[model samples]
Target: MNIASDIKPDRRERALAALAEKPDGVVEAIAGKAEVTPAEILEILPQGAAVIAGKDRFIDIWSEMTAWGTVLFIVHTDDIVLEAEGSLPAGSEGHGWFNIHGDSPIGGHIRKDNCASVTFVDRAFHGRRSCSVWFMNDKGSAMFKVFVRRDENRELIGDQLQKFEALRDRYAAS
Candidate 1:
């Protein structure tokens, strides 16, 4: 009963590909006990966030037994970005960037409630910021993630973000 076989690809790859279809997105995956049903997983959202959800199986990269399961979701990345502390980045009129939001292992936790680092190309092309949002630990390495991206079309960008935010207010689970 291996559903992963029917997909004919790895779940992480499959999940990433799903997010790729949307220009700006927030992809997510969670790995816990196998007996945990999908319904239970969906119940963990904040009391008000419309999280467009999905299901795909992931091999436990760390487990000795390959029998455990994982769940994935891809929300519009901007919803989380709007939670940023500073002004919304005016993405290059027609460019994109990885806006990372999470706690950095350093004193980042104490400095900001939501520590965000935007990846903007600086004077030097090599000096670029890495964008990511991962579920990590005390030492700060990701165990899981909420994939994020942003687009600069202002109109379309605002629409997509509003759509996601509206969904959150309507169907946010916790």
Candidate 2:
């Protein structure tokens, strides 16, 4: 069965229209209305955003993220959103998982099997065009988010934005 049909057309249209009116509120709100996850909404984001199937390229993406100088690494659960700011730790695969170990605060053995996709989210935050790499799980839940840090004027760091654009351009699967 096409389960998506469970949501009526009018409801979906209203949700999408609401999203167009306020992109920032779209994911969670629409997902709730549609009975889907935020990651599901992320996949159908407008043209400017890129959703990349990243299971095969997890390591490559991880490696690139490590070089971003400093970034905000975030994880969340039902209760709280935990954030760590620093370079991503160098990681290696062992025992069927990606082992992250370094002085960096963002260190843990990421379960390789849980990673399902990555999304390059484009939006504005704090008056600056926000850019982030979101790693998601099999159920389309956000596993973590890595954000490009901004400068004193709340502007995206030039080199980091360049790298982010390059990575998204090079890896976004058609």
Candidate 3:
């Protein structure tokens, strides 16, 4: 059964229509205007656009991401979006938090226990192809997102893209 089937049909149709009209729009925003959750929107995305993996794989996935080179890490709330461009630092679990501390500018303590799933999204954003790894909480909200960075010509960095695709494929199968 479709995970979002419980939503009213009219509302689901409206959300689908909106997504079709604006495929690159921020999903959270689209879901908000349509009175749906971001995870629900993701569930209905065009085939091949999104793949989900259980949070049990978070550590392995995060470990691989540390080698992805410079990328964009985004943390957002209802009012603001904060972005950091750097290599993801290696992290370790201690005292109920995942401590991320290394030479990179990205450092913090993440509540890894709260992460419910990891979703790999390959889609367009602002008219350009983009790829991101979304860490989602149980409430259907994104805890944060790690986006593959674009180069000077506004193209996804090839190495990172390969790594991202490989990682997605590796996890999507299991």
Each model's lDDT comes to: 0.24, 0.75, 0.89
TM-scores for all candidates: the values are: 0.22, 0.84, 0.93
Q: What are the runs in model 2 whose C-alpha is more than 4 Å off? A: 1-15
Where's the lowest-lDDT run of ten residues in candidate 2?
Answer: 1-10
Q: How many residue pairs in model 2 have overlapping backbones? A: 0
TM for candidate 1 is 0.22
lDDT for each residue of candidate 2 in 135-172, tens digit (9 for 90 to 100): 88878677888988889887889899998988887766
User: Alpha carbon lDDT of residue 115, candidate 1?
Assistant: 22
28-120 per-residue lDDT for model 1 (tens digits) = 222122222222222222232213221111111111111111112122232342222221211111123223232322111112212221111
Query: Native-vs-model 2 lDDT?
Result: 0.75
Please tell me which predicted candidate would have the highest TM-score against the true structure. Answer: 3
Each prediction's RMSD to truth: 19.0, 3.5, 1.7
Q: Would you list the rank order by lDDT, best first?
A: 3, 2, 1
**Which segments of candidate 3 are over 4 A away from where they belong?**
1-11
